[model samples]
Target chain A: MMLFFKECRKILFSLTFLIYLVAVIGFYITQFSHDAEEKISQPMQGCEDYGTIAKEVPELLMPEAAEGLVTEYLSGYYTAYPIGFYKEVKLSEKKSAKIAEIITEITGISKRELDGFSDFDEEGITMIPDGNGGYTPVVKEATLPEINIPDTMTYERFRELMRKADKIIGGGSQYSDDNIVGNFSLVPKTYEDALAEYNDIFEKDKITGAYARLFCDYMGIIVSILPVFAAAALANADRKSRMEHLIYTRKISSVKLVLTRFSALAATLAVPVILLAFIASFSVAKLYPENNTDFLAIPKMSVGWLLPNIMFSTALGMALTEISSQLMAVFVQGALWFGSIMRDTELTGDIGRFTLVCRHNSLYDRNAFMENFNEFLFNRIFYTVLAFIIIALTIWIYSEKRKGGLNVIRKNIIGKSKA
Target chain B: MEKIEIKNVNKYYGKKHALKNITLTIDQGMFGLLGRNGAGKTTLMKTLAGLHQKKNGSITICGIPVENTTEIRSITGYLPQEFSMYPNMNVYEALDYLGTLSGMTRSERKKRIDILLKKVNLTEHQHKKVKALSGGMKRRLGIAQALLHDPKVLIVDEPTAGLDPEERIRFRNLLTDAAEERIVILSTHIVGDIEASCEDIAIMNDGKILWKGTVSELINNARGNVFTVNVPQKYLSQIRKNYIVTGMLIQGDYSTVRIVSDAVPDLQGINTDEPNCEDAYMYCLYQNGCEVQGGDE
Candidate 1:
């Protein structure tokens, strides 16, 4: 174990990985600062934009609303309205209240509770002004708007309208007065959402330069692939150098070889990744001290998040290095990063979530992990076992290679087995 | 005492029979497994070194069964044909690292590295990376690493194939020094190397040993059959067409060539010289005596 650890130290503590750590941390800090809003908003001469895309629309719309959902206005907006807003918003308070009452009948929350419940601010309720631009008394507010509704109208019809609005919002088509095809008038709310409206009124344009883009692209490539390559190179050191024959001849069993190699690979990533994380966390903390974010709060960043994910990533890299040639393993890891970045969206935060390498990116989402510890535990257990399965697959492939088939592998493992 | 033993070894590659009904015992001192390339020399060496599995055979080294791979490996040291070391590692480091693989403790490995570095005369270049070393230095380093754990059986496959004549001679001398009490099975196609150092030699062709015994015995059999004839360049083509030409030396207008024939074709005053391992190997391969078990596709 000491010898194995020594080897791990030798492989992991290289100047290249250290440089990569610094470069990635520096790149993220200098480029994607926590103050993206401040830098993005400041250039309009400190003129505060009301309802910035992030502050207004995202906060106002239901958390489920897609970005730019209120589309009849801005280039970024997806549709004129959210389905619920289209159906619920245009109606008079009495009709909306009635609909709310019906919804509460099934969901068990009262109409009053449903009316006031906001996805953003728990206490705030949505309200519409009367024609005179005045607040109406609740007693008088109880009367339904004179829109023709059949006595047979059901909650199902209401749901169908909501579905249509959702489809429009999701479809990413601009909704204008000219394009309105049916009973729905334009969602009277600003076609340009408050956020879009605010950005138009006050938002500044900040263009990152070619050099910055170049730096980011280079650093991104290095961070995603270099350590993966190092791990791969280290993994096959034994096999490439024909040390397997000598090591297998010793007291070390084949199992030890597999395990030690794995540990070495994991350790290889651990040093650089942890260092990168530490640098990143520290830099983030330094740059955004006002947010009171604990960069390496032992319990939160280290244990709650980074450590377990790092372990998983390292194990994943090692297992990959074991099964495939070193270069292909690195390439697979690189492909996973590219696949994830391309897939990046609000819906899939870590687009590479499907990949073995990126499965742990959201390992412990504080908001979700806390609410569903058991579910999170289930996923962790599943992935941990999955990592081992990958390890087993690697071992099976390697053992077959060792048994003398002499198949062409992109990178030969010349090092001792990880076990 | 026999240091290594093989019992009716038979090995195959898919449908191709690489080794067929082979049996041999190796005692302490240098023994040569001589054959042309692809004559199953590597297969036999790897099986003996516990690198490759035998389809039907039992190989034992120092009373340890070849089936017990780890045990056999611990007692055996192998330098494969393609003698490679970690390119990034320095001479001493590569030796130390390989020593660790052979189950040597760090201190033990360090001590052994020191001694072996001197033995291979690479002590001065201990800090030089294997990649930076010349071909001769790298070969020496390969030998040094193989001898690190002091194994009882040392198997080197084609060790001197790509060496300057001086380096090859030096490497052979190093092998001779290390063969004190261990069984050294040197596998190569080079007959002169075996003839110079190896007391016992085995001639293999087409996956089977055509002849095996002392070199003197094989040479005595082919003594009178080899004849040297001075022929004009015109008759050189006719002689090659009729007789099995072993060697030729062209000087001025005449060519002195060695041919393997039952009797002199014409009384042209031909002289005869003693056959060396090369002569013996060529004479043994003169005719397709054994039909290659598997057709050479």
Candidate 2:
């Protein structure tokens, strides 16, 4: 325990950790703090925009999903989020025909005619300002030739066809079962729908639950990447200072020493994030003086949603740095983080099972979050367990290094890339 | 008595044989390993300290086999050839951190650090940051850290390599005091360290032990082979090419040269001179049929 504290103190005083803190706090302020505002309002009649809500309406989803599939199939490439990053997959001829078959099954449009339709309009959702001084999403329609679903086709068969299309694109497309509703099922909300959502924010969320999700959404991005810096710096400090032989010769077991050092790195890196959660909770409490607020909401949310990311990233840094070198660890983690951030198209709760940063950027969509809670739960727990597994591997590597057993690693092909 | 024993210990760095078929007995006192830079002295020390593995031979440090690294590390203290502490840590803090890793209790660490700091002559500078320490002071601190655990054996590799004469003398005296109870293994290419302190000395060359005996035995072995010859200055280069010249003093047109040879050189004013540790080491290497690159410089 004393050794852990000493290491924590050393890391807390290091320049890298200071940069980590700044990045975390800076992200909180820029991405989340500025977004702390009055979001819910009673919908008024005759407003230009009431809002948009994702509904699993077969009439609305079948046409849109079929259109998206045919257009991409014609283009001979598909966009996917297979692992939380955008991927452009050019499928084989057999797979392309499979997608065309799914499209023909849904729209009664033959693959030959789908190919003959030279161009299709691009469609997306636009956020427009309503009269209540808040933005509401309005979907834009494509002007391709009209396509209709058969009356005999059931929603289940349509869903099955969508699933086949997702499979054709290699999964994680908007047509996949896990993401279809969040992607192609958005419909404009009626006044009553807006009022119901507004009431859900107060009655169900109790105000802070909604903000907590938003806080985690913004805080999660930086924590997933920043903790790597601290972990790498701490893991490499002994060698950088030429203290490895001194520590290696000690009576302390390698497991104890390496585990204690990781504990310290994880602890120090977590302190500021948890504190920011608390501060965010308190500040959100001030936003709704009349309503009851869950003061523990952000802190609890941070522990569950953000801590796995921090631990996983930190463990990766330690294990990779121990296995190879500090610079490589940072480079690998940076590339992963960058990839994860680059293709995160859906921010209002499309949490995938393998999403590195689970995002819920809205302050009012309690239903969207609860709908995918199972996957979100799996993502967090997997990373938490994986973090420990990596640390265990790190301990083994460190013990071997201390005993001169990792000569192959030290002589790796990276040319002086080993510690 | 607690001692280190080696039985034909061998080590290799990949295909290159480092410590080959080595054998020796080191007891509780100051023992010196005298060799050139690549004589595998560091390899032997590291192997004994559980930092390297022996291929086919056996080594036991006070009955603890070298393979049992945890046990060996607990009882052995090693100071590598190049080392430093976290630069920002004060000397006291650095010692405290190391003592904690040594499994010393809090009170034990506090008390042990005070004694070790003063013993290393860093008492007044205990509060000073490690980066601010001079090279000699850092070497002293290195010894202090190695002794912080109070292990049964201490292995120091080239502890005096980059120190001034004064610091080297102080460090040698410190090691002598440390050797009063436990076995101290000092590995260095500098023969003066062995000459000043060790009684049991071994000379290694090319992964082989050339000679092993008391200081006087080594010097006595080379007594008749050391010759002092008066030669003209112009003949100095020829003598150097023909024989291993250990020392030289120049006169007006003549030079008094000291050379180690198998028999009398064909020169006038030839006399056998008493061999010091340096001359004896060169002569030992020469007698063992190893190349001796010796000169006045």
Number of the predicted model whose TM-score against the real structure is largest: 2
Indicate the TM-score of model 1.
0.68
Residue B272 C-alpha lDDT in model 2 = 88
Query: Which sections of candidate 2 miss by over 4 Å?
Result: A37-40, A45-48, A108-111, A115-146, A151-154, A416-419
Compared with the true structure, all predictions reach lDDT values of 0.58, 0.87
A303-380 per-residue lDDT for model 1 (tens digits): 323233444544556656566556556666676556544432221112121222222222112221122334444444
Which segments of candidate 1 are over 4 A away from where they belong? Answer: A9-23, A30-227, A236-251, A279-324, A334-369, A372-376, A405-419, B263-267, B287-297
Error of 2 at B98 (Å): 0.5
Q: Per candidate, chain B TM-score? A: 0.94, 0.98
Candidate 1 structure lDDT: 0.58
C-alpha RMSD values across all candidates: 14.0, 6.0
Error of 1 at B84 (Å): 2.1
Query: How far off is residue A342 in model 1, in Å?
Result: 4.3
| Residue-level lDDT tens digits of model 1 in B204-277 | 77677777788887787678778888878778877776777778889989988887655655638688878876
CA lDDT, candidate 2, residue B140: 95
Sliding window of 10 residues with minimal summed lDDT for model 1 chain A: A203-212
Residue pair clashes in candidate 2: none
